[model samples]
Target: MAAGGEPVRLIMSGAVVGQELAAEFGPLPPAMLPVGVQKLYELQLEALGGTRQHLVLPEGYGLTDYDRERLARAGVEVAPIPEGLRLGEAVVYALNSIGAGEGPVHILHGDTLIAEPPLHADDVIVGARRSNEYAWAEIETDASGRITVLVDTRAGEEGREHQPVAAGYFSFSSGVELLRSLTRMRGDFIAGVNHYAAGRPMRALGGGRWLDFGHLQTFFQSRLAVTTARAFNTVRIDGLTARKSSRDEAKIWAEAHWLQEAPPAVQVYCARLLGFGAEAGRSFYETEYEYLPVLSELFVHGALARQPWLRILASCEAFLRTCAQLSGGGSGDAALKALAADKTAARLEAFARETGFDIDAALSLEGRPAPSLRAIAERLVPAYDLQSGAADSVCHGDFCFSNILYDSRVRRIRAIDPRGLVGERPTLYGDVRYDLAKLAHSIVGRYDQIIAGRCRAERRGADFSIAFEPIACQPWLEAALGEMNVRGVRGRSVPVQAVTVSLFLSMIPLHADKPERQMAFIANALRLFLELDSQ
Candidate 1:
């Protein structure tokens, strides 16, 4: 609640660094991405008591319907800043458009978050941080910790090692008073504030933790910090700022240090819990049959890397062996029957037509209708028919590259986030070939490529490769193929490459929200199936 006892929260959404963030990460606006369980904007707003919300967005950053709906659900009314307007103009425009009433307007920068926020009813409160960087406006507070003046740190000035800088957080008792002040506001918000702050009582609350997500380095560091704090409940801080890669390395070092010297109770409880979980998981395999499922290591020894083909093949072999115990390994179950029952054909066609990827562009199925995809899916999916029968087993239903963490330094691969039971199936087990195909989707389908910023790839029939220009992916593809331990197709293709293509089709419905990813999965599945068909 504000000083007037009415609820109002104003959040500035578009950052000047949004384009840079998109280039580094995906196209998600900074407000939308995860910071622990909450989004960056969600964390900021949560600090303020729930109220009528005003979100300021820049026109350059495209707002999707999903983004708009999400913001609405979060109790926000979005005001898009025209492309030509500056940040100051945008803020003012948003404030006016949202009709911020006579109550206090809780204004916060979308790019920064405070571990301990100092916000109150009436007086102006600015979060001050002790920083070595001189890029920000400096805050000089009086003996009583009252902000006397904010120094504008000019560019090319040498940075002081320990200095106080203003972290952007503001609360105004009167929206009318703030609006009057903002009319004369310059691009520099703090400097502009000094004009209005003359003789006004203001407090400089200082704390050790402050994250400014304006830069890519700070953004990732903030993510790492919040995630670790959520997971381990504490972060060992070596220093505040560094360049990007070394900064993450420093955080990893801090994590390693804490792991060594953390409280024994913490470590012991973690161990006991993991032990119990592992025992319970193993019991399922032991009681059901002799096959061991994909096991995750309780500890990760090094940085997470991509799944190694060797570990993937080994896991598949074990899963396949387990399925060999069942009657007719490739026999279709109810789930498989339902999936292969032709409902997805229109969905595939609609996706293809929308994305400009032709499903029947296949040589044999040229100019074929949407049912052509359904026909191919029937071939790839497991069934009782001899030609389409898939060698079945207990499968990791949701296996993907993200769940597979490998440590190249330690030469170890750990599987995390196993799908315990899929689709109300009688048992956790399914098709062995599906497991093999899913792994292939990660390796051959280049699922990790788009995420790694090589967003586009080339596909022709069964052949798929990351089409990263100025960098050939042939060697990577060859190496991935070399790791397959299948009976006849090593060094050329996965023996179940056709089966993998089918699995790719099955992956589309799983990513209902990520339409582009779904489209890519659909296109690749069709291409791979066509390659097998031609052969």
Candidate 2:
């Protein structure tokens, strides 16, 4: 029971998310789609803030153990209902199965997340947003905020042009009343809503930010709205452009300069820089935004089929091979050593100081003996030094899957968000092997899965064990790694595995917000280091 004298049970109707979205985001419902590092349902649970949360899934919809675990952690119970039922019937079936009590029943369409939902109100409240799109249910409210008429605009109706519509959430006084209204209307959701509204004053609650993930365009737009930024920088997406700004002038300026100074071959593979500016002591740069799915998303979600995955890997191999040709003749060796040895050591030390993890101590990782971070760095000094006296080339310093966007329509890739620095210097070129290590870290290292919360790491003192939820593209990943290793860089054999492990160690401090993520990185680094040492 809540403080408002009515027990609130949040019913998230998942069947409405549709098959189109399901195909894009793999097997998950819209509620489970990744919004930055967390799921959409995770954000919704936090925003809605209730103890009794229930999800309604279509009949025979299978959930993985990982999915069940995450839902369990969030205290959400599942109710599977029969398929082919109308939206209203589905909600009623869900309510009957979950036993919605004599309290407030907050029905949220799974595809929508209201930032500040109007809950426990006296009147029946329907969440509203003003939009001209015919996909939504139109709502006409009187001056007193009561809904006079509600229409399902999807029935091929003429356009009202920028009217208030139901934003896929409604709060009823009790489940009993809602069920009666629904039963009377014969399970037509909008008609039931109209019937209920006619009997009682249904107010329009339209005060807060409401995100709709029902359509492809709106889905991407909502995802951008909720994405988390780095500690030092912020990115805002508006219309067809994205602007990244930072109080650290050097970082932002460097990113802009790298995009500008990239050669023709490199520029063809990256986002076009729109412009740069300074506003209120912050430096900023804008770029043309392409609403393409990031490789990380597609990879982790099992969204692309096996052949597409192979083609993407092939495309990436071609891009990196092209980059290797833009050599600066070993000028970046010193920078590479600084990054692989010096900066990595410093960052590991900083991570230790921040988390009290003792990186100097040895570890027993996954039943295998692992060396301390200091020892690993010591051995890697010579390994990274091997890249010296070899050809260096133009680099996308952060060439990981997450930084690359793939457009399936054109079968091309666009790289975004370069590291913009090599050992504290802002430059466009580095040892090409460093870029290879970044890609390896994503594929062989599973860095993006950790970022996407698809892995678990548990640590007891210096002993650690971690496992990523099984991804569907394992064979493709192995093939990609084999291709990369065989290709090497500029026909020179580089210690990519060793450098990839170091890359994981170096990025620990950058993700300090989630300690579990930091620990996952450490565990993954140890695992990779053991494999490298054995080889």
lDDT by residue (tens digit), candidate 1, 1-535: 4557664566676554455454333344456554433457766766654657776766676554544566787777776677556555666677777777677766767777776665554545555554334367777667887767777776457555465677776666776666666667654466556654664656666533787766655665565555432221222233332111122233333323322332343222111111111122122110111011111110101111234434444544443344334433435344344333343454566556556555554322223222345567656544222243444444444455544433333433333333433343323344444445556565566554443333444445533443331213334543654565432224234335655666566556556656656646655665566566566
Model 1 has an lDDT value of 0.49
- Residue-level lDDT of model 2, residues 233-302, one tens digit each, is 8888876898999998888888898899988888878898999999989999999998777888777754
Clash numbers, per candidate? 7, 0
**Clashing pairs in model 2?**
none
In model 1, which residue pairs have backbone atoms overlapping below 3 Å?
Answer: 329-392, 330-390, 392-432, 393-430, 393-431, 393-432, 461-527
Best by TM-score: 2
Per-candidate TM-score against the hidden true structure: 0.49, 0.88
Off by over 4 Å in 2: 1-13, 16-23, 101-103, 142-145, 155-158, 277-279, 300-303, 331-335, 349-359, 382-389, 485-494, 512-516
